[model samples]
Target chain A: MKKHIRKTAVLSILTTVALVLSYVEAILPPIWAAVPGIKIGLPNIIIIFILYKTGLKDAITVSVIRLFLVALLFGNAMTLLYSAAGAILSIALMTLCKKINLFSMVGVSIVGGVAHNLGQILVAMAIFETSQIGYYMLVLAVTGTIAGVFVGIAASIILKRFEKIKI
Target chain B: MKNNNSQKNQKLRNDIILAVVIVFIAAAGLLLFVLTKQEGSTVAVKIDGVVTDTYPLSENREVSIKTGENDENINILTIKDGKASISEADCPDKICVETRAVSFVGETIVCLPHKIVIEITNEKTDDQIDVAV
Candidate 1:
């Protein structure tokens, strides 16, 4: 019972952290205005932390819930649709990488970020009904990889400190 | 302790391999993007999936697109110096306005809320740039 309680408490806190990071991201000015939809993906820190601490299923739960709640709070239907596709694909890729455990935290984060961009592009292609949209991701990949590094570093630091306090 | 060392070595190898792969992929994609780019001779303005106008990039002009029945959803497109960009947009994101001018074929600035698409096209032209070279 105590372990279960600890798990729930930690997950809830992680969820809140993810939610706040997302809100802060939305309010912050675009880091690169010329590139649309570019974000540092701060929420990925908590997602990665949860994945490391618990497992893939819990991490996915946290991501799906965070997406739904964020949509309700800050976005509309279109934003929701775009983010949902991105989040699902990103989580899936991260989970696969985590299962393999071949890469370090940074590499997993990079994979997640790149998958996120690819997923968003897929959604945009579907919405626009055109395949030429694939070209845009090429440009986006540069920044996405850079942002992934930032998120990976942040997650690495947090997870390290978090290890000292795991119940 | 030996097991831990091997695990660490494995992780190091994986990180190097993953980093190299991603960077290589990014470089390849960028190269393809640049190579495939063609100079656009015209800009096609589409509102709600219908082409409303095609303006020549060689011409300098400003077009105010009324995205809705009313004058509220307006996006001003500007063409100058052989490039096209959104000078103004009332959409909340202002994403269209933020995109820099595009003069390459297949480049687009889309405002999803307004259902506005500004695409650069390599339309057949009789211009000297195309004929001289």
Candidate 2:
């Protein structure tokens, strides 16, 4: 019973950390070199960490909650739909990868990242009411891979340390 | 374990293929941007559903369009002779501004929140007979 409580508390703390990281990322100046919508996706590290530590359910919960709160706080209602689409798609892809054991945390992260971009593009297309904007998808996919690999490496390090921690 | 290993390898190969395809598409887009260059088209700026200004596209120009009833200010667009680009935007993330110029058929510039869109269409002529009629 106590273990369950501890897990819940840890999940909440991790969610808070993810929220803060997302806010910080929002404030940072974007480094737009190759693509327009590309960013480092720094907040994804926390999501990856939570996925490795707790499990898929907790990770999904964290992702959905973080997305909702972040959108509300930012007051960008349109973004809420986009973020939800991306988060759900990413989590679904990561969970599938986990089930198949087709890759390590890094692999799953990469898949999630790519899926997130796909989801965002889908939303953009719907919003724009035109499919011509699909040209941007290729750029987003490449950028998503790079960001995913970075987050995956960070998740691996955190997971390793998490295994050693007693509490 | 063997099945898992093979499956993992397959997924990795798939991702690589996907990445390659994306790269090819990006390269094609870059080529297209280079190939179909045009000069000097008239651009009209609209903010929150109202026509604000019109200008000729010769060189990059940035104009600010303020959202009515809100403090939000969006860069109207950049124009360079028959080509227009979204140079900057006040909205969060500025995703629209990052979009490339509309040089091809059926291309559009959109700011969803602001309900602003600038589209490029073939000029219509009154003398042209309607084939469907």
Q: Per-residue error at A84 for model 1, in Å?
A: 1.0
Query: How many clashes (backbone atoms < 3 Å, residues ≥3 apart in a chain or on different chains) does model 2 have?
Result: 6
Candidate 1 Cα outliers beyond 4 Å, as residue runs: A164-167, B48-50, B69-71, B125-133
- Sort candidate 1 into its docking category: acceptable
Task: Please write out the lDDT profile of model 2 over residues B69-127, one tens digit for every residue.
Answer: 66566556766656777777776556677767864444667776675666554333212
Local accuracy of candidate 2 as per-residue lDDT tens digits, A1-167: 89888888888888899999889877787667325557667778888887777777788888888998999897478889887888889888888877876567777777788788888889877765556557667677777877887888898898888897532
The local distance difference test score of model 1 is: 0.85
Considering chain A alone, report the TM-score of candidate 1 relative to the true chain A. Answer: 0.94
lDDT of 1 by residue, B1-133 (tens): 9999999788868876776777788789878888888898999987766778999999999999996777679899999999999999889989899888999988898888898888998667546668879
